[model samples]
Target: MARTASLSGFPEWLPQERVVEQHVLDTLRRVFELHGFGSIETRAVETVGQLLRKGEIDKEVYGLSRLQDDDDSAAKSDPNALALHFDLTVPFARYVVENAGYLAFPFRRYQMQKVWRGERPQEGRAREFTQADIDVVGDGELPFRYDVEIVLVIAEALSALPIPEFRLRVNNRKLSEGFYRGIGLEDTAGVLRSIDKLEKIGAEKVAELLRTELGATQEQAEAALKLATIQTTDTSFVEQVRALGVEHPLLEEGLTELEQVVAAASSRAPGKVVADLSIARGLDYYTGTVVETVLVGHEQLGSICSGGRYESLASKGSKTFPGVGLSIGVTRLVSRILSQEFATASRSVPTAVLVTLNDEDSWSAAQDVAAQLRARGISTEVAAKADKFGKQIKFADRRGIPFVWFTDAEGAHQVKDIRSGEQVAADPAVWTPAEEDLRPQVIARVAAEV
Candidate 1:
């Protein structure tokens, strides 16, 4: 069982629980590498100015400062104030800009690291959590194909994990902004922000906000609401949006891009991708295709994965880096998996074999046997104390250690399967556990439960 955190939102998993988390991280890393995304890690802290460049996330940024300062240091305001990064994308954009000279154009990279967010704690929301992100950034301009490719790559990664059914709902900012402009709404960003809250506040409340806050007419608000309601699993959403009688060059451009994404996804990932016009990623930096994913039957938990395209997030004077990316909320997904009993580790401990000490003086002999097993690629641990034979066996059993090694007075060796009461004479130099028993296994729960 996992222990409850003394401080809410900061999750600390127990050893067995950590096994599940590690398994998830390892799986993501393997899948990301297979897709040719090289791994990169940015520093935890970034200047306050750098972090705030992309969005109005000052409330979520955890600023850093000294606990004690000398008189001279306190007299002057620090020009470079720092804060823990709230997300990987902004920092990655900065990294690209800073390293533009050394990096090749159209760089592909994957980052898995902890990010701090100062938000209210909830079941799926954490103050600090791990995010697994993959992005392709290019110099000057990036291809539209990358937007579609990101969706497929993330779908493949999520499908590899033992999770419930998920849907990658996608949209394009150009489509949304153009639709708003088509209806004579000038504050497209303000309108997008309001429509983004449709799920949380509902259509009626969102329409009210658009009218009262953004000075939008009821007809304009209604048109935006109608656009937000359009959703489909294929390119059919193109007609659904067109049915609203809205037209703009940007809207048409967005429609073509989103259509390509959904059409390709239909053949590649099938039902995993959908054209969800309401997916307005609240972040201002996302300039094109935006995506938000939810686990089916657990939509209340919110997006387990999300990201979008950015045209100007990274730039140096005249050079601009356009990119498409996606990020998986690793901690949130793992927490849900464990709480719902979606999967479990086979053993709490990694040791495959526990070599028992015959006596206090036989410790050296037990070590030799353990070394032999270790050299053969088996995880072996010598008993800590020369307890009675039964006691040592009980210790191994309690830890879920399947095999226990025993040494006789004459140095003959025997191994016992604790779960099954079977003992066999074996050579430490050649004996090997079943392949499945070599390491901890992540066993998914039954289909019905999942």
Candidate 2:
């Protein structure tokens, strides 16, 4: 039998769930804008060469090809006759390069957009998902202090969201690079990538892959695994690793800077950020600091926030772009929140006061009440159906609408708080709801993420 066709690659939810998603996005925007980052959006596709600059991301691209170009031979054609973007960072780099003249140095911007990947979707992975990204691109040579700002803003943004428990894991590429080279391994990135899979692949097999495929001696592989597994709730882990007598100078510098970021963020939200040496952001490009955030109880879902510093991501007119930034995986974070039923939101329609239409003759009176409330900046909606008064109340109740306004034959208006099932006579022109009553809310989550 032919089954129902479900939407492929794309996922959506009910209105209340969407409200949660919107709240998360809005909080991100508020934080980014407060930090003086401008906003921008880039086109979704780039040429094949542009997309494959690093080669590692090519597998994730859902490539686009012209119908004519692929009609004769689909197998051998370059995918970018039109390709869906795999991530936003590449496009932003291209955007800055393309608009080099108009853009200012240290270009600060926030982007929220959907990116697609051709992957076998599972519990937390999605083929089509949204990412909220913020980056600062200077003409060249970004001050490392901006790395401090990136972590601060990301920690602030996630703190504003209604999530119970999350911690931003911090690391430095220079530390990893120097340490790997110090240990005499040339393919450090390959080793870092393998270490990234540590959470997915247990230590035993990872040790084997490191020694065999990554070409690490057994002792070197074991040390790398130990470094990857050494996670802590604070910066002391860096010192713990250093106690083993590692001799890389950059490792010392990485630890010092990571301590500064933790101290900065802890002033606002204590214990919400941590320095972990294992968080080698899988991408090879990150040149300085890196981050990976995991929810406390839902740690298995993995990092919901990730990005890092790339000092030379763009090139134009003899100036290379040096940038520091972070990307919040909107889809992944929202999905985790949804799966555990961890969020609450007001109705999506936002009709705070639904004016009742008692009958056809009195409909205009209800409309007047609605208009008056709306004029006062209250969200008001006139009941569409001239049904029974009981049915009208039921409609408002079904929507979780807080207040129901009724107009009697005498042209007097009354308001009811649906939650309390209480009503009172009030003048729409003179009476105002309490400020907190008007605002939408997510259930107060744990102030200190669990």
Candidate 3:
């Protein structure tokens, strides 16, 4: 047998991880649907040109080709091959443009899909990652109300997760851009790129790089760095900066908007959001209301959610299509949560009740029990193997099946809860398991002594 090397950048999770992943996805879909965001999926391919125009030159984009083109290398380079979609937004923009004529105005759509990136894979960053995105776009112009709605919806979605504490630190691109311009910084993009590395490279290193690499003046570099590092718990941070005599109208306006967003977001999702000036989301396309959510103690996981408003991103002309959005990196969040034991599965199998198939002759009784229980909204599966009672119980226990139904000539079913080692004989139509046992009770069970 030949050995195969583990593919780089592509990661597959264990069974437990898969359970966590599904949980995260299910929660995201529920929130997205609750807020009227319909689901749409785009193919995992785009032209190299569209991807390049999207941004980030260094991103590793794996080109596609048919095996037929393997012989002719030039054939692989033909225009027919499509690049994997980098993020949901770019492909979504192209989707809206193509579907504009038939689609309704103010298109609110939520997408859950994997995106490929040609970057170094470490920790949260991966060659392939899953992102749960919700974006609102109109035919030509996007409304400001949708911007707040997008941010607010994402915050609510994340709050549903089992994380201890997190803050959705949001800032407007206009505020940052206007501040950059008013403070006499010529290259706002360049300054933002440096500020984005504030977490990675630290403030001192970022300031030095800004001055040396970006040709920023010492004072300008320091001010920008301070803004990137500056964080506040509430709108009070706005007044804190104002007291600094920042003396920039754009900065003042940014502070004002921050105040409004905090008040508004807090009114709805109180204490779930905050205004942090340092949230310079290191992206070129983001034009306003940048956001980066951070879990209190696990700030090391970095921003679990991030995105911002972009102006005229989908148009051929400069007609503003200003919209704001944030993506919950499901893969990243799930990985951290599972790795850190943040969420525990209730059961291994999706089934709550297991019906034992005693034998081929009596299998009908077990099948009948399954049908009756299922009709009652109980997830019951007939044991594929008609093994002994001990073996059947072992199978259920191994998979963390909470309740097992045992049939007898009494023409009835009995229920057993695995955890407490309790068994009760009753009618399959009337008996009920606790809420924890109703669904897949997946979790890491404590190891028994050998």
Candidate 4:
């Protein structure tokens, strides 16, 4: 108890900063609900076996253990048998399988929750963070159309947020894996893991890894890199990949699928989406379309939103629930907004008007005045002490409260605009601030700068 310290990866926001965060969460929820996605919340911890079902994230999983369990009992139960979930999708997949018998087919759910990871933290990547995710699952066969629709849903969601302009770079695992196969390479997964590091480790090093680790020949590595470089805002990427002279049945199928996604998304979201060949998504289960979004000028922040299609993410008996999902890195996005001043709350606190106390004797009357304003849906706060008029005004100013209410000797109320120093007589029952002044509004810095 004597030791006090701070954790590096856990992020906490200040009041004004939280205003922006809450607005982002609200905006995401509103848009998801409008799209007919039902809200769901899952438990924080999942069985360790469930967490490691995918296998690639073993190092990042934080195992849980109980402190008071007897040694013998603890030994019988796997020491690291339970752990916090690393992502929403895994836990959700398990949930669907467990509840499939009672749930409807083509179930659409949106989940906003905190997920924990024990990975090294950096800008935009944290040990603990909030993710806003949406997924559509189907009983037997999930339409490929959901893959296209998922990105469009994300594009619409991002358009409504206060973040900078962004581009959703999409690719399909089948497209990449099929291409690798057509090129006579058996280690498609290894080649993919190598190419996924294109941005991180650069082409030369990645080429070396492909040749050394995957035993890919010189021509195969070059061809893989060539495919990775073929990016287009339209469906032209289909021709670009076809022109590679590598032919396989899976390759053709993947090309047709990707073309349809890019075409459908282009007609809907226009320039917001592109068929970027480099997006491998790293995860092994992404069977179809994969997406990764980058803020136009802030690519260093990495993917602010990402997810993909998993053909067998959830299953029960002979039935498999295929799904497509996307997650918005809420903490990562909001942190950049606050750090770069990309957006800001109009006020530090929710209270828009501070009702000044005329005197200690008028406390009851002051409380009544605040009650009336609040009843009318206005954010009002009553002063705790009857300080000097000048000091009370300063109190309102310090908290960015736009208006200050003062009562005359006879209890006649007057409201003053702290910003403009304009005072006007007003009725406590009917008076309201401007529509925009009722609650804190998050303003984008680019617009504010203008």
Candidate 5:
């Protein structure tokens, strides 16, 4: 019974669909908390300057203005001009800076909230969606181990959800920039922007862009393409890059760091992480490791999760806060889950038992039974009308309520499992439904099918 979306990019789920989404959110929260990431929420709106300062997402930002305000009140050039935040990272960086005094060093936090964009809606793309982000920001200096940790944590979180197999394609910005520089490509960022499209476009197209747009020679462009194509699940990528004969001090440093990440992940989360050098992220802020995740067979849907290390994203006058993080596109995942029937809720409603009224005069008795059942921690509701027992059972069945309660004329109580038609005398004070029946179950469709 989900309603069609009135607006193209905004998604609205029915009660049952929402239950599945809630299960995803709850599972993510539990895993994140178990890893020691505290939850926090940032404001939905940030200044235009703030939103645009970190990433090249100005075109995606939705400006904020009150109806009563003048047309010129929300100027993009104005530092105070307000717009909805496009992602959690920028606002979180700002938050860390403003509250640096109150926050402990290397603050680990997770935020799940709606973010807005002005993209053309398509499968896995939307104007507004919920994102779940986990970040660990440090004071002045963040260790490289966190970069590796972020991948493992994300792997664990995604594994816990009822989703298909995914691979975290990871790369290091330093490694990319260093190799590009070693090959005499001065416009490292420009080359990265082109390489980021290697998946969408082909290798030839990306190399052509590198030469035409960045003024690189055919040899340099080919080298860049070769580097981008080097991908492996372990540290073998290090030798592959070295075979290209590219050498720079920064390049060596990047190789070491990236090798460390891949080496750690090979043991901790084998087959889950890959050294994908083409993952440029196309953002100017990501200074070190970057990651992009894709479901095994759904690469066309794009990355369901992405983030990286930002060494200079947040800074006070004297100190800088470097952080590593990843964000899960919760809405996009849920959309695919629902569309593909990946999982479903057992019931649309939470009521476990429906207390039926035997007659118009038995309404008070039904209420008493419902209250007693509720007091015992059962989700029980009284029937709205004194309909026939058949009609009452139909109502409960429609809502997926498994049990129905009946009060006899002699004050005896009995409960019937609508699913099984098994009726048994019971006491409202002590009767308890099976633990699994007390709440709606989020059953994985794959497992159910198996």
Candidate 6:
């Protein structure tokens, strides 16, 4: 017999779990809008060529085809085959190019949507997940200050979420590449790719790859490892790099630019952003600042947010669009929150009060009461059955609805706080639950502990 089972990478949450996810998405949206970011959602499917523009993510792209079309026929008919977008950045670049005639320059936008990747699924990684992204795109020559602003905006967004304290690890690709060249390594991009695997393949393995694959000597590999290990919470990292005795004009420029970002971030959001020289974002387009954020004490989950500046990712007919962006891994964040029980919703449903039916004939009266409560901006639900007072109360209790409303022979109404068994006279037309109890609330478990 055929059996049914859930696909491993596609996650589905229970009602309360979904409540927490919604609260997170709402919080991110509120913060993005508060910072004057307009919202736009790009198409879910992009041409396979468009998705592979960056060249590194070809393996992760999920190609699409009509069920009726065979491979040879489809390839001949449609030269530009479609595929689900692997990341929001590429699609946004395409969007900027396609609509350049209409949009204002230096456009700021926030996008929250699901993305697919045909990759192995791990604890915090999923094949189908949601990412919340914010980007500032310029017509040409985007200022260095916007890079710092991107860090500030992301710091604020992360701070507002109900998660453990986080550290935004900042780095400059110019610094890394220039440092490699200063150390007599000709292949800076090759060196970066090897160093990017330092975390996964261990220091010793990475050293071997550098020497064997990139034709680097033992000293060059050691120096690269040293560069990656240099991390500081303040601008002192600049002096530390100066002490390294490697000098290049690009290195000096990157150091100055990174110092400015770290200084601004420290003054605005102290201790939130750190200068970690080792953060080499593997993407080829990240020409300037790169960042990866990890939750405190949960380092195993990997970076929950990451992005950088792409100086020339979006270009249209001789005009270059330099953009800086940050993306929050929504699914990974929600998964960590749920798996660790870091936060929970007050109730599964939004109903704050259940209007109980006293008898079979009183159903209409309860409905009226519920209607009045709902009209007044209160989340109220009428009981499904007029079986017994105990049964009606039980129904509300099962749903975690705090209040149970009842009517008397004289048409007087009283609502009971099921938790405390406190019944008080109420006017359905004007009565309201306590502000805190009005709707489903997302409560941080840590706050309750405190």
TM-score, per-candidate, Cα-based: 0.97, 0.90, 0.88, 0.94, 0.97, 0.95
Ranking by lDDT: 1, 5, 6, 4, 2, 3
Model 2 lDDT tens row, 1-450 = 112218655667677777778878888899899999999998987776777665386667777765665363443255445677888998898898989799888789999999898877755678888999999988867888888889888888888777876898988877776677667777878888877777787888878888889788988887777677666666667677786566778767777777777777667667878877778877777888999988998888877889998866677767789888898989888877776667766555666888888788777778887778889888888888899988888998887778888878787878999789888999989777777567566553445221
Worst 10 residues of 3 by lDDT: 441-450
Clashes of each: 0, 2, 11, 0, 0, 0
Give lDDT tens digits, candidate 4, residues 1-450: 011117878888877888999989998998899999999999999887777777488778776766775564453346347788999999999999999888898999999999999867776888999999999999988998988888888988888887778999999888898999998898888888899999999989999999899888899999999999999999999888888898988888888888988998889989999899999988887888889999999999999999999988797777899999999999999888888888888887989889998789888898899999999999999888999999999999998899999998987889999999999999999999998899998888762221
Local accuracy by lDDT, each model: 0.91, 0.79, 0.75, 0.88, 0.91, 0.89
Residue 35 error, candidate 3, Å: 1.8
Candidate 2 has an lDDT of 0.79
Error of 6 at 257 (Å): 1.1
- Give candidate 5 misplaced runs (Cα > 4 Å): 1-3, 72-74, 447-450
Error of 6 at 73 (Å): 9.9
Lowest-lDDT window of 10 residues in candidate 5? 441-450
TM-score of 4: 0.94
RMSD (Å) per prediction: 2.1, 3.4, 4.6, 3.1, 1.8, 2.9
Candidate 1 C-alpha lDDT tens digits along 1-450? 367899999999988889989988998899899989999999999888888887777888787876674443432234367789999999999999999999987999999999999999987899999999999999999999999999999998998887899999999999999998999998998988888899998999998999999999989988898888889999999999998889999999999999999999999999999999998989999999999999999999999999999999998888899999999999999988999889999998899999999889999989999899999889999999999999999999999899999989998889999989899999998999999999999888834211
What TM-score quantifies how close candidate 6 is to the native fold?
Answer: 0.95
- By lDDT, the better pick of 5 and 6 is 5
- What TM-score does candidate 3 reach? 0.88
Superposition TM-score, candidate 1 onto the true structure: 0.97
